[model samples]
Target chain A: MTAYDPARRPRVAVLCSFNVDLVHGPLSEALAARGLPSELYFSGYGQWESDLHNSASELYRFGPQVVVVYPDLRDVVPAFGSTVPSKHEAEAAGAEAASALGQGIETFLSRAPGATVLCTGLTVPPVNALGLLEGNAGYSWRSAANAFNAHIQDLSEGQGRLFFLDIEPVIQRVGWTAWNDSRLWCIGRMRLARDAYPHLAAFWARAIRAMLTPRRKCLVLDLDNTLWGGVVGEDGLDGIQLGHSGAGLAFLEFQRAVKTLPARGVLLAVCSKNNRDDALEVFRAHPSMVLEASDFTAMEIGWDDKATGLRRIADRVGIGLDSLVFWDDSPVERALVRRALPEVLVPEVPEDPALHAEFLHGLEAFDTLTLTREDIRRSAMYREEAQRKTVRAAMAEGPPEAFYRACGIEMTVVRADDFSLPRLSQMVMKTNQFNMSTKRYSTAEIAAFMRAPDIDVHALRVSDRFGDLGIVGMAIVRRDTSPWLLDTFLLSCRALGRTIEHGFLGFLSRRATSAGAGLRALYIPTARNAPVKRFLDELGLEPVPAGGETFHVTIPSGLVAIPSWLTLTIEE
Target chain B: MSDKLLYETVARVLRVPLETIDIDSSPETIARWDSMAQVALMLEVESVFSVRLHSDSLMALNSVRKIRDALVHLGALPEAP
Candidate 1:
């Protein structure tokens, strides 16, 4: 299936404390705001406890990719009254409440280990107790909430797939008095304010997008008002608003915000309709400029239209337009790019430059929930790809084989373990084009495979002089008898043309021969598996072409040749 | 103004058209105004009028007129609009 297919939008289960009737409407709108779609399933009101414990419950039946457990103050408290209960009674109730909630969370994780769980912390009311003696009481409303939220945070740290969403910060941002409307709570049992739905939706959507959707990899910026307060071509380096002083601090703050993206593997590029030398001067000469020339992965600074510039940046970065996010202060340029390149995300910069930093922070577009080791080094990987391209450009026209040989590509095949299993399974699920047998397995299932005696699972880590692309391929072999069957085999698209698959198959063949069995790899013909289809045939395997999916090479018979460009090493 | 406003709030809470509601509509006649809807309607009316209905009055919210009369007794509704 093509990337960004609507049907593949991550499935999310919103197990809410209140009636999710009104909240569901804004949840969809929040996803639309980020261009991430979700198939949301709402559990019955307050069924989070039952759904978490029962395997046959709706939570398991729906099989959501992400579960958002949102609880309000009303959900935990059976009754609300202005008259405060005695200090002794309050203490008893608080301990009981925390235990029940903690137990429910523990049971849910035991049943659902692979699915991501994002639980919202309880929001403390503006006034916890009646008069002002809440501080004197040991089990005050605030204290109870603090204990419960802290427990959730601890549970999140303990559990492999759990995160505590601190709703208190959001409430404080909009003021608790304004956020907790007395009208909606008393009248409709709608604990969360209707007006606050948009904010809550936007907040939770960032987390859901991060967990389920691929984040924007490349952030394309305009040099004029985007990177600085004024157009660099006209303002010149010293004159541009990018320093510690008034009006200039705003651009400095904006530059500081842009610098954080690269650390998280978001590639930074400059696309502007200005002289390249003029833009370079700011990055070079400006003492206060937080960004530098080396910081940007690519630069397309010229008088060309932004759409064309964005295309060149995308091409240079080796990513598609859909993965690029364009930031420009000019509304006309943003509008033109929006109309021309509909795939690219061009967020509108505030008219006032002072709000630009806050605007970028509010977007929350480029971040995700889980950051793997591969993800942290992704920007460097693309820069390496750019380096490879430069080398290709410098090579006085020859066969591409000489370039591949000189690149010093190496592959290490190792057995799957706890550390590498997550990436291995993720590659199995996300990699589409180069996959021979498009088998998708969860981390839990991969663990099961690792435990099984007859099944062998191996993953490959490839690297070159430029950088390392960690754990980009996975292979699962079922070795019960002679002619061992290839259960699941796939390589990431990034490692495809480099012929890492040859080393992968060669390693599997050696293992099969050592086990005193013949080697057989199967290719279930899929629309995207054409590349694999050709490689499987050329491996010198006996083609049982008449069947649906069969190719076998007996030991001392099947041709197993490792490419000279790649140094293959098998790890214990 | 408060009388008309009270009727509009009840209609909205019950998910019924304003024209379809009056002082006589109760849970027995309105299919959607079940136990949960009754609690919702009473909460909404109490919030709109800035007056809390008694726990006993929760079951007595049988008809729109009864609700109006309770609001009037609580001095929440203006004198007969």
Candidate 2:
């Protein structure tokens, strides 16, 4: 782990509805433990509103990359939490509270356009105004809080950068009794208990890590006693426990949890020491199985060691070994993988099966801040890539161009618009290998670039005979410079082997030629970006004599041609 | 536990040297013992000694001696002879 460097850490501003200073120390420790050492700025007690509304406030002066706007129900809807308001009043109060907070958030976002605001949902107070009748009552504090949370979700519908932190699960995990401290609340306005501060801080740190860091790509699982209650090799298909009742229900719940991960872009892979036919039979014949054969991108069901299986999965999924998270019920197998592949993240599996689902949810390795169209379909895209691989392997003797041409690659180049901004920003942040001068621009910065008259922000959406790989490449060019400077040029690793990089560059070169300007790009060498230099060399670029890692290439007007097989469409 | 452990916890929480946290150390003597630090110090004391302080004891816990007395009352430490 790297030591904490104050200058390099992201600035985080925590604004709470109550005295949240107790979390400052724990939040620092939590973030540092997660390998994201960040500088924290806390607003005065109950000053979240003023800090958000006032442009000249200290929060704006702090200029945080992430701001946590945490509101308590006691502060937002006092009537719902304390007084026995009528149903109409409770409903109205919830709406009014959400509306005011939404407006303040809008003001803050407009003022601090580059910061990602993490607003929390109001937690239902343990003691409702209506007491035990709160459920049957038309609308109580619980209802009001629910309405407030729903409205917060509604407010974040179109705002890609505004993330709503759902704190209900955290409260449940910590227990309401342990989370709230009435004594401290009365004495110092500290609403959260001392014991709960670390848990809450850990949760917040997970959100921060998701927003700012690269997420783990895949979860590799062992089959026997892990996904199912019994070992399939010994117990056979019918004997394995994975049904709605008995001990099998726990396994069913765990499978259901794992099934939801693919929708969030975490690929699933199987690494089990069992017959491959038995695993396939379970998937095909078992009626209680929540996951299908197609759900997993890679299936390594053999007698090989777990470390080799994990490496094969990473290779098959086109990700790094560090991006793989392995989980197995057998401690021996987990220890083996941990010792052999230190880069792989292997979390401890609880002895009890009932805790597996909760344990999986507790792991922050699969958390992602944004879910784009590409992310939602990432598993299916990898499956498609597997098919493409098979086609290439069948035609092993053919030239690389012939293989690429057979895939019927199509590139749709468009100027960065509001719809494409999120994917463009994500590519700028996450694309490392194929990036030339990796400059991570926020969504606001990319939007500003789109509006700048002297700058061009282009996004590439690629599709093939298989499926659409949404927004795979992006480039930011400074048109004001003499030689048009390529401020950012990156392509997704998934779309690398094809000639998409060349097609993307050819499109940019043609545009530069039309403007009567040469193209100059900088390849700042990073540990993971040696592939970018190869791409530059293939383009016949020469480094300028200024000693900086700069490449300048003059495009002869109408000379640079996009690959003939690639169907190109440009949208202004 | 030991008197040294209590002083160590206070010193660690307040980010001061252990030698600075004596029995007479109070908010008046320590610069960082403001309202926020006071609450944090009490939380640290509760966690370190595994004892909950009453509201009265919490309010009166301004000095290291008072904190030790509160711990003694809660049966986390032996009473003074």
Highest TM-score: give the candidate number: 2
lDDT of 2 by residue, A449-517 (tens): 999999999999999998888888999999999789888889989899888888888899888877789
Model 1: CA > 4 A from native:
A1-68, A72-99, A106-117, A123-147, A154-162, A181-215, A314-320, A396-408, A426-449, A452-455, A474-490, A496-549, A553-569, B1-81
Cα lDDT, model 1, residue A476:
88
Name the runs in model 2 displaced over 4 angstroms.
A1-7, A78-82, A132-138, A229-231, A391-417, A420-466, A470-572, B1-25, B28-31, B44-53, B64-80
lDDT of each model, Cα atoms only?
0.76, 0.85
lDDT of 1 by residue, A1-572 (tens): 11244667777788877765556767888887777767788887667677777889878888776888887765675543544766556545555665677777777767776577888887667665545777664436665566667777877776767888878878888776556656455555556544576778888887776666677888898887777778788877877787787778888898998888877778899988888788888888888889887778899988889899999988877889999989887888899999999999888778887888888767666866556677778778877877877887787498877888878999998989988977887787888888877877888899999999999888899998878878888888988856898877899888877678887787787778777786776566677878876875675444455365644434242366577788988895
RMSD versus native structure for model 2: 6.2
As for candidate 2, its clashing pairs are: none
What's the i-RMS of each model?
6.3, 1.0
